[model samples]
Target: MAEQTQPADMSRWPLVIAGGFFLIMLAIFVVAFIVLSGEDTGMDADDITETAYMDIVTPLLVDADPERGREHFQRYGCTACHGNQNLAPAVDVMIASAGERRPPMQAVAYIYESIIYPGAFVVPGYQNNMPRTYSDTIDEAHLGDLIAFLSGVEAEPAPEIPEDDPLSIETPSGDDATDADEEFALSADGNVILTPALIREYEDLAEFLLAGANPERGPELVIEYGCSVCHGDLAAGILAAGYAEMGQMAAERRPPLSAAAYLYEAIIYPRRNTVEGWDDNMPDDYAEMISTVDLGDIIAYLLTYADE
Candidate 1:
């Protein structure tokens, strides 16, 4: 007589369906948010322009400039061996065959590999005579620009970053252990390799080397080499506060360095004696960018800030 059974429960079906619809809407919203955020930055893995390593500027692959690359090619003396020198395949020839050199490797990537790792894929009958130190010596941060030029793509350079945006140097301040100048110092000419061995040899430098240098040319060098990128536009009255009176201020800031000597050290090894309240983000490659004569000129120009 007790055959009681439960009726099919219809009450919970609407609740389950509502929950399922809510989850679907949430998922769609999340996907849309992600897509929009990514596109807002307009950056890809290859287009990332950040300087978190080695105080070098790694520009986006898409922002490469062929004209800039040509300047580097000629400035670096590629003609010495490749083109007119005829020791190896001309750069044009190599660039033309870049796509074919390494199967499946993109032409731009192949060109970049050739510059960075010349031995990555060598052409037959052409001994790998390209100097391996290019990555270290040249402004390799913009090597992609050179690669684009070689590949004949001629992409426009990355647009000038506004003052409000992240600087060409996107790295956080004081994050790089290598930028610290505690264990190493650069030579006078800025050509010396900085090593951490027990003994590091530095050139005996003069206290004042402004005698024969042309200070007039210093400003041009500063802008041309992109020092203005971090330091600001000197012509527009935009200058570092510490550098306002860097000549007289230099000695007090860095004792016993002599104003000129300190300037030399600062240019070659910026973080060697960083000024208070300033980030140690300046690239310590100024020495390589200028000649001894040119360095003297820059120092001479900087000394004028003392008189001002």
Candidate 2:
């Protein structure tokens, strides 16, 4: 028998296979073009989104003015707790001790901290009462201006005493002894009062204290100084030791030493002006143990919260 011959219809099979292959290749090319284009466009879209986000989030730096800050102080109620023109005021009425000497720069530093981290150092009696006023309400530039104004303030002069006339002198002794009293008065005038010398000493101490005061070192000193013992941990407003008697104390008794500036003074001059009720508890001899510079550091550390 002869071999079977192939059918003629088989001639179209190769053409059908070639057509199918061409269609598949075209489909793959289309997919590749779409995927590449999408990736490139996606990157461009992401770049635009990132730029817009940065513009919204970045904060702008501005120059601060102390004069404006002083105005802000009055407008913002700082004097409510501190005082008005007379730096010294009645201690019990939310103000600090009268006649207490504090450096202007140190006060500025304190103001800065109080504004940022208001709760960090709660003036003993005023804890929880001190408002949380900084974070988002005021920006950095305004805070700096407030600091500038506080630092620029200088202490006012003391009033002068008048010479006494003989008639004005009160005699504790009922019997009159004019000649003897005159000699005693002359001797009193002749003796030099060491007040000027004492003032000079205090000035020197302040200089020493300020030399090492930096905000960076404040937190450590807070704990080291035993402030945490009474002001609560991290100054979050918990009364530690000796806080219970704050109310019984006179207005001058526990006048809010929780502010960074007030705290600095409380530590440096513990007995300078006793807080009415808590006077017995506070240490009176800081001069022997801590330096002025260390006190400044404590002030700096406390200021960390002014913006908090």
Candidate 3:
């Protein structure tokens, strides 16, 4: 019999099979990372302690007033993320959980720890998205009042500030009444004390951003905002930078930051810096169009795609 003819491509079959297997493994890894990392875990209950926040809490306890704290709660926008807002545990739920975790845990101490070190014991099933700025932005006594209300503890009445105080609305005298613009002071602590007019303006702007970035509704946002046009569908390529080819292209730039940080800087400061191949034509008005809270939601939405 004539010698069996051999095809030239036959020798390449092994290499092709090995390549196919390697790709399958890579895909499995990517999927596994996404699934596992998406499950948020809070700080262990054992680690949360009353002493950690005692320095700040001790001062407030002397004059803690639950009623006064309730007002501060709304002023600082704590309602924006907790309870019915569904971003974090509701006030009642959090207190209840604290009670369960450490049966002997004092309500005041638990509330204090939560406000000062939110990340210390993330209520199970809640994201650790609570801002850590409360300790600084809220005076210790005011914070105590808030804790007092949340923990159902009775507190003293907060001292009243005079209505005519600079932080208060002032009667316009002379030609200033017709000026229509009230004096606005930017608090040194970065909290904006909005005048009624400014508050209306803020509400208008917030409405324009579609009730802020609904991170849970991020997929649609990517399309609505046309993010995919420049960055590609982030959901489609979660690890875009991890590819070998991308590493070579990004050799000169600093290592990429967290998805939240990068997206935030990109939106607020479009001209500040940009990705390697993209143009800087992103509308400069987004800073004025969206609230910082909304920007954070967008970042949170985008972070869902992060491989990490």
Top candidate when judged by lDDT against the true structure = 1
Query: Could you give candidate 2's per-residue lDDT for residues 1-308 as a string of tens digits?
Result: 22236565686688899999999999999999999998788645335332332242223113556555554453333433344223212223221321122232134444444555555444444434444534444546656656555544332222111112222222222232222233322224232122444345544554555565796776565456544444544432322222222212212322232344344445554433334222122333344445667777765555455444
Q: How far out, in Å, is residue 78 in model 2?
A: 34
Instruction: Kindly list the per-residue Cα lDDT of model 1 for residues 1-308, writing each as its tens digit.
Output: 23235344665677799999999999999999999998986655455322221122234355667766654554444533554324567655766686787766667766766776677667788776665656665655357667776776743443222222212222222432234344344445332233433111222353335667787887776655545434534312222443355665765654444567667777775644455554334455555566777778777777778776
> Stretches of candidate 1 above 4 Å error?
1-142, 145-204, 234-239
How many residue-pair clashes does candidate 1 contain? 0
TM-score of each: 0.37, 0.26, 0.36
**What is candidate 3's lDDT per residue for 1-308, written digit by digit as tens?**
22236565886788899999999999999999887775543234554455644555667878887766665664444543452335566666654555465446567777777777777667777677666655655656667778777776643333232322222322223331221243445455322343566445434543444344566765555444434433443212331232222223332332233334335545654433445443233433355445456565665565554533
Model 1 residue pairs with clashes: none
TM-score winner: 1
What TM-score does model 2 achieve against the real structure?
0.26
Regions of candidate 2 where Cα sits further than 4 Å from its true position: 1-200, 233-265, 291-293, 303-308
| Deviation (Å) of 71 in candidate 2 | 49
Where does the lowest 10-residue lDDT sum fall in candidate 3? 163-172
Error of 2 at 39 (Å): 67
- Candidate lDDT (C-alpha), each: 0.56, 0.43, 0.51
